[model samples]
Target: MSAHNFLGNLQTYTDGLVEEGKTPAVSVAVWKDGQLHLAASGILNVETGVEATTDSIFQIGSITKIMTVSIIMQLVDEGKIDIDMPVRTYLRDFAIADAEASETITVRQLINHTNGMSGDFFPDESRQSGNQIARYLDRINRLPLIHPVGEYYSYSNAAFAVAGRLIEVVTGVSWYNAIEERIYQPLGMSHAISHPMDVIRYRAAIGHFADQTHPEGWKQTEQLYLSMGQAAAGATLTMRAEDLITFGRAHLEGGITQTGERWLSKTSLAQMQVQQVNVPTVSKAFTKGYGLGWGLLHHKQPEDTVYGHGGVTYGQLSMLRVIPKQNICFAILINCSEMGMMTEITNRFLNELASLDYSEAQAKFVNLSSVEQKRFLGTYASLGDGFRIVSEEDHLVAYYEDTVLKTPVERYSLGALEDDFFYGFNRDGSVALELQFKDCQKDGRYSYLFSGGHLRKRVLE
Candidate 1:
């Protein structure tokens, strides 16, 4: 299809999809061959009955991490910081519960999520103050190292908080301000704002939760944002889909802005996309590997690699995908927490536009022996998340718990895949879970469960 017809069909599909009640609102922007196409449909808020427009700002969640890392890279370009240098080189008093890790963790490890620090270390007090980064530092002693430093890949929000502090210390500015001056302003992203207060000036979309009790089958989320302390890790950044894609285009153009200005060095941009660690297969639904701040999606061919990130905040879901080989990038923003819908949209968008499919490769399913299955049947936990796998009628079922968000318990059935990996399907048979058991202990039980970008330890009863 021609580009004109493809974008028109995308817009029509988006309109119909929203009307199907998957989500209350969504905004999408596509950048291909130096042209921009945008689409929007549905209401910004069910309560207000306000129509969403192409310019409506939705929380980009962890996509903000890219901006955070961009500022850190800029510091590197200026010789003000070094990725290999220990974070303590700048934040002299920075220390975590693990003294050795506190002293030895480098800035690169923090950005690439290899620091082994607890991933979800949000404090209630941090949300109540503007000096959240400082409060986060004061409470750093509470977070324990989940694994040995540089042992493996584990998503770390605290790591980025440390990165944010490093940015603040080296630049003499707040993380939010640094992002504005360095990224938003440089890229001409006028619709982007890292601070929640600034959101009021734009046509911002309110988040919605899937609530069967509500008349519309969804309700507005009580909280509008996450803890300010984790802002660098994607707590409170909002932007129009257009602006989000513009940010992606900067990286796509190798640090050059749309107006021919150099926002970042080509060397730093290349380093950010280089794979730092290979993620677990189960987590490949999100990413195949980790870069500095980007998620590397390795397609069938090496040159077809795609760089992107996903974000979630309260009841919103956002995704940004950039395929440099095709000079194509797209951003999707939705107000409701409907992940299944987001996945569907992402697959369709990529397949239709770039002729690239991100659908999970069909794993060779195998039946594990009863004893082998028992190795994975137990409780696994990270900081605020956990899973309990139980066997029923020769099949494994997992119960997921989200303590931080207080979400309802969810259940998934695990089908054994190759090499201790499992495909988790919801009751509706959607392949929403990717997980693996790794690091066997001397007692024959696996020491860790890798899923959702977290290396959760098996909880011993």
Candidate 2:
């Protein structure tokens, strides 16, 4: 199909999806075979009745992590930092609650999420004055390791915040300013902004929450951003979908900008895209493994190699995907927290444009005896949330509680896929969760539950 016809069809499909109330708004940018296509649909804000356009800016969430790691890699290229070296080598004062782990954690561990520190250490304050990334250390110092250092893959937002601080120390500039100077300007991404205040200069999209009580079945989110201090972990960065793919295009071209200017060495770019650690089997729906900052999709197939990142903050969710061998890049930004909608859109785009299918790969269900299920039944909890597994008639059910968000509890039915691995189905029978039990105790009960990128310990009564 011609690029013109493809874009027109995409625009129509996006419009129909939004009109069906899947989400409030969405903007997409696709670059394939040296051609760029852009499409957008729905209102930026229902309250304001502003229509979304290709230029509309939406929070890119954790996709900001790629920008953060790009800067870190630049430092690597300049010989100012080493990925394998201990993080404390550069940040002398760096210390977490586990002093031993803090001293031994490497720069590579932080970027790949093997540092094992608690992932969701958001400070109470918002937009604090003076080096917010640096000030994050005072709070992170108290966090205990959720897993042994470099032994497990537990996503850590705090680790990346520490990395952001390392950038400030090495460059003598705020993390925000460093990215703007090194990434945004050089890549010609004029539509990007790291601060919320600057969002006024563009047609910015406000996040939306699904509210059945509202007449429109959705309402604008009360909070627009997550904690500002964790900007390195994808808190406050907003940009147009076009600008996002621009950055991805640079990486797709092996770290060279459109004008043939080298932003990072080919070596560093390759390092960032290579698999650093394997993720849980459930995570393979989106990525099989993780690279330095990029999530490795189709890592085993070199000819079809693709790497990208997804971001979430407040009510917004965003995704960026790149197929290096095809010289293709695409970005999707939405103002509502709708994972299913995003997944469908991603699968459709990839199937049509790249001849690739991205459907979730589900494991076959294996029935477990009551004796087998008994060992896994219990409450497993993290700092802010937990899951209580109870045996139902034929399968196990997990009651999920969100302590931090104070949202209503959700329930999922668990079907054993193996001795310790299980896939969870929502009430609607959708396969939305995958979890594993690890670290069995002498008493025959498991000691930890790995789900949702967190390792939650078994809570005793």
Candidate 3:
């Protein structure tokens, strides 16, 4: 359970994957009481033969939402901004594809993704200044909506960019300075920067696409386009695993800076953890609902709650989870876009530390009732893709192109209802399926909606 042993286990898991040619590089850190536990595996710079280091910076991507959410909450505490007030009330230029929804959208809704905004249309220059971001607000009129504001969960980075611009309008300071003074510097996250354009010369990892023929390989993305939406997610900050641990500790300690600065009141931090909108549509890799800037996960057994955020870009993936009740927080950064790999490694690392057996948890889905078993026996299809799902006795599975089905048909319990659809939980008891079934069809399909424009579909075969 010690930090050293925990990190050693992580190194083994990530290194094993690296040797198998799965991940190029991965960095991990754990924090408790302002202390850091660090570990690294694989190469930081493959060409230079540089081993991954604690300070090796990788794009944290949408994890920048955390800094945005924290600063907004601080403003709320100071009465400079009201969470319920419409976003346009403060920034007159704010507009949405749907005029009515735009008029009603509030600051809290924007941060929690309850705003109707979808997709990234903020003309890459918006991340620079308030005026630049405001100029892009006119484009929202052409965007489309998946659902009405506050009605259903739909992730949108564009919404965050607009939120960031609103922050500048209210604070009269650059979004970068607000985050640095309020969140990063206060938390001692020195290496974390808002713009990748500034850090290109530093020791940072370039993202690579496994499909080399594709245009998104590491070499191609070395010069990613800068955006005015940087506040929403343009920050290409990198940090030592230890520094990230310090960042996690701030949330674990309820918004208290590592040096004892109470950046936001406990009540405001609590609001950040409240499940304002259900994200049942997001992937199993995500959780049940979204708080202000974090994902809300509910754990059974010992009965605990976790609040954190995750980010993914072209070639990197990052996750930060905080079990406040356990006084444990961990962050994982991988220089590969292996879906769920970071989550898998983080879970395995936590298992070793908690000394909790997962056998029972893993085995929970083995047995299936005749009725439950029969329901999965019919043909199923994904909504977006034409792929079909068929049941093989007790196992439900699917296949698309050359990818094969590894494991399917496990025991799952229904979680709460979100917009009339039920989400499923796996043996580890985390929400895994966001599904809805028709009695006539007898076969159900599942879709995971992770932030805006990111959707995954699967048929239960």
Report every candidate's CA lDDT: 0.87, 0.85, 0.62
- For model 3, residues 175-229, the per-residue Cα lDDT tens digits are 7778777877778877776654567555676565465554322232343433554
lDDT of 2 by residue, 1-461 (tens): 64446666878878987989999999999998788888899989989999999999999988988899999999999999999999999999888889999899999999999998878777666535666777888777878887788888877788899999999999998898898899999999999998777999999999888998988778888777777778998988999999998999989887889899989999999899999998776544444779989987773356776788888877789999998887788999999988877878877777777767676565677878889889999998866778999998857899999765455798998878865888888889887778989889898899889887778878788
What is the lDDT ranking, best to worst? Answer: 1, 2, 3
Predicted model with the maximum lDDT: 1
Among the numbered candidates, top TM-score falls to 1
Model 3 whole-model lDDT (C-alpha atoms): 0.62
- Stretches off by above 4 angstroms in model 1 are 1-4, 282-287, 360-363
Instruction: Give the clash total for candidate 2.
Output: 1
TM-score of each: 0.96, 0.95, 0.75
For candidate 1, write residues 1-461 as lDDT tens digits: 65568897777867887878899999999998788999999889989889899989999989988889999999999999989989889998888889999899999999999999989876665337568887788788868888899999999988998889888888898888898899889899999988888889999999999888887778998877777888899999999999998899999988999899888999999899999898887543344888999999887777688889999889999999999999999999999988888889887878888777666656678887788778888999988898999998888999999877778999999988877888889999988878898898888899888888898888888
lDDT of 2: 0.85
For each of the candidates, give the backbone clash count. Answer: 0, 1, 16
Supply candidate 2's per-residue lDDT for 399: 93
